[model samples]
Target: MRSPQLRDATSPTGCALTATTALARLPALAPCLPEFSDIVPWPRRRGCRADAVVGWGQRPTTARARQWALRHQLPFIALEEGFLRSWGPAAEGYASHSLVVDHSGIYYDASAPSDLESLIEHGRISPEDELRASGLIARLRHSRLSKVNHAPDIPLPASPRPRVLVVDQTRNDASIVGGLADRQRFHQMLDHALTRHPDADILVKVHPEVIAGRRQGHLEHAGRHPRCQLLADDINPWALFDAVQAVHVVTSQLGFEALLAGLPVTCHGLPFYAGWGLTTDHLRCPRRHRRASLPRLFAAAYLHYSRYANPYTGAPSTLEDTLDLLEDQQRHIDAGRGHWRCHGLSRWKQRFVGDFLGPKACVSHHSQGRFEPSAVATSTERQLLWGSQIPAATGVSRMEDGFLRSVGLGIDLVRPLSLVIDRCGIHYDPGRPSELERLIAHGRFSPRELARAARLIQQLRQHKLSKYNPHHEPSRLPELPGNRPRLLVVGQVESDASVRLGAGRIRTNAQLLREVRRTRPDAFIVYRPHPDVMAGVRQGAQVSSDDWDRLVADVDITTLIDRVDEVHTMTSLTGFEALIRERRVVTYGMPFYAGWGLTQDHVPAPDRRGRKISLEQLVVAALIRYPRYVDPCSRQLINVETAVQLLASARQNPPELTLFQRLYRLTRRYLHGPY
Candidate 1:
């Protein structure tokens, strides 16, 4: 007998998929239980009585076994994909897959009592649980329920055309067979879609599995039509949903996802999500006849009905844990999946990030146009573009990271802010609305979320946290002659991508400072140049003391901010930090934090930032909810509390540099010349 490090527990019906998970969660099954596969035939051929039976719900095979289990007076545990968002592909139920292993009745079965709705009424959910649920919803909207690819956008025709999408499912799935649908075939759904929406352009999208050729779908053999087009592109499902006016489905998960994405869904089947008054349903189930809001439905399905295991530890986890795991998984897959040549990275920088990033992925330093462009484009998985802007490469996906930098505190040598990892691109570039901005602008913050945001804001304020560490001691400011309101003009790199994309009217630091002087001439103006420009790593327009009344350096920014009544900037995070301190802020550009009605705005982000919300709500959505943090020592996924503590400790006691790091610093300084 094996030591049981990996358990192979089975149910009485023996209709279960293989689950290779950690030993900690192995269920208590009979020691003498036979293998699951062996018991599949015995339930139908010979009657056997047992305590319980476990199987995935609604499949043809499992449905029969479940009936047998009920007939024999045994309890049945129904397994299904957790109705909430998932990190990876949910269709494949392998090890490390998140699931809803429910003991109460399965959600889709109309005849049985529901575990999901009961939890909404009676479950003892905590504040943290609510926070997790809110975070999951935000991620779904921001990343479009995808952990892997964010930029998988397939642009549609530019010609004006109204489009309606009909999402297809695998022919043999349990959802169709067991959900009591009128027609399970994709062709039947297509004909109905064409007839219902005559004026609109109809696009039939097949499941990802069908595209991969792993399984057969109804449209596999159906001849293509001139009016209706079958789409098998690699575009993300969420993107497809966004492009279409409405979505039609028969027991497909896409219908549920489309509803969450705020699309009108017409369902031909009685899936769990349909008949809830949210979607227009052709088939009705009495169980879900009660009307419900999206959030309440999300709470019932995600927080109550499902169980999640930690992606890192394999222990049972929460929604917060799932977010962290998904972020980690996203970073890992992005970094480790494709073979690529990294551009614009120094040898030392490569070594620095590579050690922490592990060796599963390939990283090579090659100058632009040095490698064979054709070979590099075709051979590797994705091109790792290491900069503020993406390269001109046409074909491959771009895995954008901010060149092995951290966002935490103290010297950049030891403690770092968390590494920025984005599948499409980094957050600062306003070329497209970054995920953080999307979350802040569109995400709904509940009362519990607002409370959590309040706590995080308190932490940031008490600790005097800003984007960069305060390397110098707090110095006394020049005393203002009178009590006239003081103004601080924040400066940033003129050539930075954020300025190019977001700094709409006033482009440079000097221009912003001059504008501030013209606007508030009487107010005592203080200008602080960007640290990167001062360090000579980045360039900015010159701003002498003549440009502003006073130019300050070698002093803590917190001290400078304290002496001023107002802070002005063009898309600097400093403006947001000042907002944290409750100071009056005016913006020349639409930074992610701006346009929320919290700051005096000079530009418009009307489409992106129209959802009027509170400052506490913004903090919860951006800091507590959006950003991913990692422990510096353990290199593991961590919560916001742990990240804050690590940064605080780094600020208090700056870590000493090793000899090699010191040498590297010296070499880098000599190579870059003076600031």
Candidate 2:
């Protein structure tokens, strides 16, 4: 008796008790036993109810028994070993079913062996299973069948030239048409075959789902070929088999069907059906060890009787049937309509959601019919608000409605100031009226040299600002009842110094804290590390502390301040938020708002520094100047306002840029004097 393993083997219905012992017991307890050979007769006394009988025997005996069972309408299970032994070692037998058996003596049993064998001989496994298991037969009843159905009835054309059929599914959504590797390869093979055989009619059948309007076809280039005819009309594959002399494929299952038809197949890739002796191989299989004949190969796959349940009905069916039914269900689902939730009301919903409601409205502006405040604003209103002049040679109009519309649509509008600043980090020196005259007198500068003048002015502006704001006033520091004036710096801590070009001496965070403490001994410096910094990519385990004292311990620093009323940052949302609270801001980098003569800028201003602009204008410039806004849902680039709404959710949970802010100040001190 076979001992049952505690783990139940799954069946279509559910788990069933399966064991060698249970099977052995079947012969003894069967109530209606089939006529058995004298060599292995059933025990007559232990009668059990079994609907049918199956057993091992010689080929002649098993065949005779199978005939009798079929006549009596009884199910018969044949032991595979007898067939293999009778066929002899030279005979490969059926390739598909060869590997069905396991070492445990468990073998797959096709419900009707004779029917399954006939289907395999006809090379109709996929379609036959689809008809038997899914409502595909019923669906076909509503549609027209091709004129030809059987292999023999289909007549070959007068020409004996090889015809190649290329099959591929095109509805995969992850890629665009002509983008998938398999699809591209299939087209390449088709082109190669057509170029080789110009007269050959390449019948390209669209996948059934794509034909039925259940999915979109990705093969847009299919129509361009003069020799290729797209089979949009309902035509059976058997009909196609009669027309085509040969087949070429990348990895379609049709290659398998072509083999069963005895037609030569050229595989560009190693599909499951390609390696076995069944098909004429054009491509070598990478997995050389597992190749076998078609029948034995399939027997191992289909005859193995583990039933899969339907997701919708929860009823058991063969694995083949389960897939067919699932595809059918998907087709039906794709044909139906769907509902969508409104996204227009997102801003209203976002406001009441939590503490992360982004930067408060510091200023508001009027547009055509709409009154809204820019969510992200800087204190220097003019630099953020005004539009710059366009040059005549550039053929650009600053006031062109279309140009404004383009800017509003999120197109990068190149401003004279922005171009100069980005290139040389400088702006014009208005205070030195004769500065341009001096350059002209020295023959050192021209109209093109105005850009050089701007850079010098920007450097002077940064120098004067840094000199005056050397240290924060102790009185201006929030009254936290502490002897130390706490300064909080927030932003990206590590620079290219840590990654590409390794500079060993630059300890960015350490240098910044040391400089700030040196400038104001009475102030406590709190270093809040960037969230991205603490993500554990590098900098070792030492960088993981939020505690001020722990963060600034080894650097020349005063006591670390943990919390503060004022926050400083470079391009961090915290900077914008801090400004809404009316806190004095000192910026290290020329993030969009810096150098409008607004917040103290670390970098020199641009050459054509525009008048002080509003926060809205700055937001608009950055949106139009820097990165393009790509819509996630539609995959289209949208305007700045749309980009703003997309990023507005960041306001709800504004992050602190502790590490970056500290590093910027540290770099400044290192470049200026001593850290």
lDDT of 1 by residue, 1-675 (tens): 001212234433343321112221332111222234332223233443345566655555466657766687666666665554443332332233245655677766645566664554455656555655566677778755543333344567643677898877777666675567533446677888888888878888875678789887776543366667778765767778767899988877778778778889988876777766888887766545466666666766766665555332233445554554455445544444445566655454565444333334565666655644466445645455554533444443333222112332222244443444444444565556665667776678767557756867787777766666555655455665456778988888776666877888899887887788888878888888887556544445677566687777555676678778999999888887888888999999977788778999888765766777788977876676555455555454444544565566667875555796567556655565322
Can you write out model 2's per-residue Cα lDDT over 320-437, one digit (the tens) per residue? Answer: 3333322322222221112211112223222221111111112222222231124213223211111122111121111111111111111111111111111111112222212111
Indicate the worst ten consecutive residues by lDDT in candidate 2: 411-420
The residue-level lDDT of candidate 2 at 388 comes to 25
What candidate 2 gets wrong by more than 4 Å, as runs, is 1-162, 171-181, 208-218, 280-283, 305-675
Cα deviation at 562, candidate 2, in Å, is: 94
- Model 1: residue 660 alpha-carbon error in angstroms: 18
* TM accuracy, model 1: 0.49
| Clashing pairs counted in every model | 5, 53
Candidate 1: Cα lDDT at 188:
72
Per-model TM-score on C-alpha atoms = 0.49, 0.25
On a 0 to 100 scale, what is the lDDT of residue 497 in model 1? 65
